[model samples]
Target: MKELYLLLLCMVTTSLGKNKSVDLELDYETASRLAGLPLHCAHVEYPNKLSQVLENQTELLAPSELHPIFYGCFDWHSSVHGHWLLAKVANLFPDTELHQNVRTLFAQQFTEDKVATELAYFNRKWGKSFERTYGWAWLLKLQEELELFKDEKFQEYAQILKPLADYIADLYIDFLPRLSYPVRVGEHTNTAFGLVFALDYARLDGNEKLIEVIRNVSLTFYTPDYDCPLRYEPSGYDFLSPCLQEAEVMSKILDDDLEYSVWLQKFLPQLFAENFVLEPGKVADRTDGKLVHLDGLNFSRAWALYTITKKLDDKDMVERLNAIGDEHIRTSIDNVVGSDYAGSHWLASFLFHALETRNS
Candidate 1:
């Protein structure tokens, strides 16, 4: 595998200042570093955050006991997407050491017993809405990536993981309609961000129910939207870009390029301007868990804006998008590879997702 790595992708170097530049590419070294964060923490259960509801003293269980598969990486959602990050990286670079390690980890973790325990936790009284759409989306994303990878063992893992996936899908189907308005926050509850991945998984899984619910929810919440407050974006402690997340989700559901472009222009007219300038969010500190969200904000904004660029015929706007996208990546990627657990526990998944969306 190390020998084969010599043929791996080259790095993309971007200038940070007069003489300083950074490697923010999707090459092997960067990918390996990103994948390493999750591989190390996915099963390390200490220093975990449990956002659970306790029915009684009997429910005072450890995170590993509560979620057999997703009990690490700081929190349940981060753990779920950490698995997703590994599956995605392993999918891209199969026959590698990273892929083998991921295979081994999944074999140990993605068993019927583990998934059943996880599902039971979800089905518990007062636990139905636990992790809600965020963790659900990541779990679906993990299954989605597993199904896309080439290995037969990944399919087996996906099958073992399917019951939980189906449960989350049903949660979406049940919850979307009853909600009168979308959760437009920039954090875990952001409806648009959750729907984007869930919709992708739904379409891939051919779950028409999930797909239909997502489409209806999108149109219901966003079709009438206009003049999104992108300039007021990244409210402190924010990760997902509220404005761009909505636009990106709409880009997928619209009927045609013309239709989507029109809707986008109406919704976010600044993108149509001659010199549309948007800078990445600045993180003043990496040690603070909430403050570090700005780093993820930069990456997520890039991911959403990159998807919007695909449907654009405007060459200048697309170039602006690509430039800002790279800028966002370069701004926040260092922290993803840093030692601080505040950002390291989850930011790699955001970086990988942003890079994947940018490259795709």
Candidate 2:
């Protein structure tokens, strides 16, 4: 049995390298490997920080003790998106061991009681920014994935997680109004990156208020922004393109194709050029957590470019962007498998997001 599994894994890995199309889907073995990562770490806690404020003695607790459902993959947001990756893979390969692993993990960790404990941490005095918008966005993305899965077990998991999801949605509605300015950083706290995922979930779940808030806030923050200075982009530790992230959110918020085209023209006019080029971000050291973020930057840039292409009607432009997206994916998709723990722990989710966006 072990030899058979190894043979199958090798076959899948080989097939992945041979198929280099822009629409390349994650084969079962690749999905299983990526899903296996989170499954391996979902419970192993030690290299963990609560990212919380301690109001009392009880607040100083181990990660698993504090966040029963999300205490692994090095941090809160990574753990959340790790679960998202698992949920995605399980849906893709429902009859495989990947599904069984997700089922077992969800059954053990996604109980209402566990989620309540997770929620309690968020309700703490200094918890308003616990995971801030990044973690909150991913939790909603997980909920959206769960809601989409037709399996009864996934539906149950969605129901179990709905309260937490609802809380995050409410937080967005309350938080966005009070947020005077959007965080335009290329890292975790970037407001546009947060809104992109939250808006996706809100639209899918029919949360009118949440959708309205995101749309309004996005336009307010990003509209009239011209000359985004892509040349000055990619600060040393950036995992996201601040300029592209803004473009991503605005693309969703604006409904009119012409208006969006006009907005993109002003927002990222460089893209409108006939021979525009965006080199994939380079990572100096995969073992260095911050440096490895460049890998993620490549994937995210691909996602943003792919998303922007959807709103455009220019066939040549779309084709060019699609090729660029493929270049970005190729640069990092291979690195995802054998990178240092710093990169391996979370990069797969970004890769999955990029590929999923391309295939969508």
Candidate 3:
């Protein structure tokens, strides 16, 4: 299983070929642009979403008052991953002006007192399920990037955030067992999408308990599943592909090459056949907050396709998958920047993660 994880990581970070399908080169120019998305919004705390449960008048505090660092980017989860996006770009392109800007942001947001306040927010009864698995997953992923980043400052920041990260981890350890049914929606509540990054953090942290629980829970929820209803996807306001996210989680859990193949064949048989092809989702309105999710759907599908294709042994199938993933990315990568505040507030992280899986 550990070997499978290592293979997946290698495949995710490697280029498919010299003949690229999209112009996703994360040169300093592109990285800086994507970095600008989070940088611009991470501090702009208005037009925010709390997703909170107000128990008393005191609970009506503003978003920034609730989560200082994760208060911008429209919502908590977006801002959490927004920080992850900055950590990623800063690590990839060091000594740049944006890198220093990221450092400054970290210095301001990751202070011990601020993180403690953030932790206090989570402990409230009304806030216990604040972001549930979605925001929890992104927060852990941010911790992963902070610890992975090779810098003294980043290490200190990671320590400052460690208490909250550990708290979130405990929440996961406690929550998974109580979840009798999986959330299969193509939205923030999707259980599979929530597990992807959290699992990544578990493996990175060498938290064997977390890895074991995720593997066990995945097996229980998905092992017997077959013939996923993938065609019925992108229901109106979806930022995620339920079928693809589930497949990605399965790809992570099932270790044996042939075991994964058999499972995938039963679950999404269309992948192995050349007659069926996946297309990028269309968004009718980028200005509408809900409608813009299709743009995110396209990028998310790219991430899943890029990672899932690496599990296949068939060379031709791999190439086809790569092409599909590239097209999905191409369809939305350029649209992410300056699209609309609705989409622009959160789409760059999706685009960045997808591009990284394809060696951007």
Pairs with backbone N, CA or C atoms under 3 Å apart (clashes), candidate 2: none
Candidate 2 displacement at residue 325 in angstroms: 1.2
Tens-digit lDDT string for candidate 1 (37-99): 788888779898999778899999998999898998889999999999989888898888878
lDDT string, candidate 2, 117-232, tens digits: 98888787888778889999999999999999989999999999999999999999999999899998999999999998899899899999999999888888899799999998
- Overall local distance difference test of candidate 1: 0.85
Off by over 4 Å in 3: 1-22
Q: Against the hidden true structure, what lDDT does model 2 obtain?
A: 0.85
The true-structure Cα RMSD of candidate 3 reads: 7.3
Worst 10 residues of 2 by lDDT: 1-10
What TM-score would you give candidate 1 relative to the actual structure? 0.93
For candidate 3, the 10 contiguous residues with the lowest summed lDDT are 1-10
Full-model lDDT for every candidate:
0.85, 0.85, 0.85
Candidate order by TM-score, highest to lowest?
Answer: 2, 1, 3
